[model samples]
Target: MDTSFLDSLSDSDFDLDLHLIMGKKSSQKKFATMLDSDDTDSMSSSTSSMRLDNMTENGLSEVQVGKDDLLDQCLDALYEKRGSTREKALASIIESFNSSLQNEFVETKFATLLQQCLNSIKKGSAKEVALASHAIGLLAVTVGPGEKAQEILEESLSPISDALRIRPETSKILSLLQCLAVITFVGGEDPEQTEKSMHIMWQVARPKLGANVAAFKPSPAVIAMMVSSWSFLLTTVNGWALNPKSWQESILYFSTLLDKDDRALRIAAGEALALIFEIGNLDKFCGENKDSSEPTIDEGKDSRKLMYLHGLRTKILGQVRGLSAEAGGKGSAKKDLNSQRNTFRDILDFLEDGYTPETSMKIGGDPLNTSSWTQLIQLNFLKHFLGGGFVKHMQENQFLHDVFGFTPKKKLLSGTEQRMSGSEKRMYKSPNSALSKARTQLLNKQRTLAQGRNAGHFAVDE
Candidate 1:
């Protein structure tokens, strides 16, 4: 099958209508295109607040009824007999989610929403599966890290893994890969759980051969997405916690991908390699894992391990150097070539000078900084996966703020909102202030402890 069709696709291919919010569907383009910038025409909170003050009791009740009915209708639509109906319902759910963080909705209907999405993945068409996968990701994000988040992971992982076991369309594969990365990011609190997720992604890209299972080859697009999603999860893992044999083979495998015909695959592999190098536990990658029954390594083995590390680094550095200066070929995309060149150049600089590139971006006018490859990969992956919702989550989702160490500037009240009493004002901002600071600190501490364990300081010998 010609998989090149995937290369021509973009987020706009998934554009959905928003008329469902008004109890009907229209041909007009309503939802923001996926993987694109936030629309400037987004409804303003200040404007909505003012409108609320003017609404009569009946009008306000009608508005509430509209929202409640829309959600109920979408949820019910999931159970409809037609695939298109289920797809539209999933799309409407996606629009409502991207427009706002559905904290209260998830709190009340987490299990039902999750199970419905999972059912779609198991039985719906390719498009339906894609949308359902995306909705599941959003559900996990809204729930954040807690028992509920863990439950999402536990309930969804098997169904997602099962769906991926069969060959699917490029969009479906992309969605499932992204969904796996996201749920694990939010819910897989332990390194083992995270590693388990990574392993699942690996198997999808390169399934193990068995007597009944023929050797399966994934498309370049699938391979690229797998590498990216795999690297996204790698950002949270500590270097020392990784299996020596697995990552040793991974570094070598990625180096080979650098020579692939596909530019996207090359770029994805380059980024993954750069992240591995940035993590920096080369000795561990080279050394043989000593079992309890076996004696410790002797001097000869130690010298061999050191030699292997040096040779591996040299090979990877050569590949990076070559890619950094690669010339454009016949029929090559100038944009893709430039992207590959820029990525490799950054990797080259880091490998040679130990200078990881620093990135800064604005979230609601506040800066979010990432000074390492890991953070940068995590940020980029999440931004791409979140699509138009990225900005909304950055502004309002405390989970995201904590993950990126971002603090969106507090907005001054305007219109009718300014008329609130001092106590009301304090109460309004308290959730964004006090609880936020405490959760941020707690998350930071948990990450620190996780890193310490990854360092092998707290790990027991296997």
Candidate 2:
């Protein structure tokens, strides 16, 4: 095994997200306090300065300006003839997006931003194309599961496909794969739409070219990415709606990937298989399409399919058992080895005991929980895809809130906001505050009644 390739596997696992272009994180505070508040125009100047300071630290010092203005500048830059200029503009836009939710900006400029990004995909350099891909994905996330999301999917598919046809660099391919997964996950209104995107992704891993066309075999990294991205979109699809024969073939194909030398490829295949089993329609995925009331076309054919599925399951179980206890090989990355072991172990546990993995995490004072592989995969994929903005969306994005069934306790307060004094805190219930006014009126009416009963009774006269 090539050590460099093995090392690449370790780094490529979750590198599909925007962390590549966003660069290293500097100590930064979120600027958008209005995320929790209704008034968008009420951000204090001090907090605005803090936001600018963070962006300056990220090397956007010269472009320190209001969010809308910065976005406008980026939009204008996208139209510039230079690829480097467009790349910087796309990077700035991605930074702005990952730092905060740009709902208002997206609402007004959604089409324009998307069209520009797609143009970049069609014309820009590989780096620019990757950045453009990341920007569009963030756009889908910001819009989040509605008409706008669907429109994004519709518009992005063609240009992205055209880009993929050229077989760009590994980074560009990874970015485009993730972008496809994200847009489809949010915008795919039905299973068919989701499956269409999956088909596009799957072709990268298993391409079929004409006799004269040069064959483009995917490296392990690309294959792993294809599997991971395909599985991410798979979580949104309904198993019943899938083609039975195709999935059975997929099961066979993924099982083969488990034996590959790349640890990341094995881990991704393991997760994909685990999700398939978790869906628990083995009969459907194994090529049995007849309803219970319908007569069997051929008993022998059905039986053979069942037997074939059982053999595949048994083979996979044995393979998973070996991987769960795999010893580290020479030249193998310890981290990658352990990750493979852990993942396969989880898959083995689920296959044998019928128990899915459960996990929990804090998302802005709210518990985002997942008790199944499907939910966990969805959560982790989106987290990596959103990167810094995960918390922002998890906290304030209603679409995500609905998807995850998460409701935050309260909006997060900014660092610049001052703590209230005891008297000021009490004033929230002191009848002067707007929230307490109605309750105060009710209390005043009650006080009037109570005074009559106790009138002149201070000395026990009553």
Best by TM-score: 1
Kindly give the stretch of ten consecutive residues in candidate 1 with the minimal lDDT sum.
Answer: 27-36
Model 1 lDDT tens row, 1-462: 887898777656544333344433221112111101121222211111112122213132333435545555567668777676566567767777877877767768889999999999999888888889988898877777778888989999999998898878888888899999999988887778988899899997778889977677899989999999999888777677776556556776787898899999998998887776666675444443444134565767667766666677777778888888999899999999899899889888877665666889887778888866777787888898777788998887767766777766653333235566544642112123344346445544544444333333211223
Backbone clash pairs in model 1 (N, Cα, C under 3 Å; residues 3+ apart or in different chains), count: 0
**Local distance difference test values of all predictions, in order:** 0.71, 0.71
Taking all chains together, the TM-score of candidate 1 against the true structure is 0.76
TM-score per model over all chains:
0.76, 0.74
Q: Candidate 2 on 184-267: residue-level lDDT in tens?
A: 977777778888888889889887678865688888989998999998887765566776545546777888999999998999
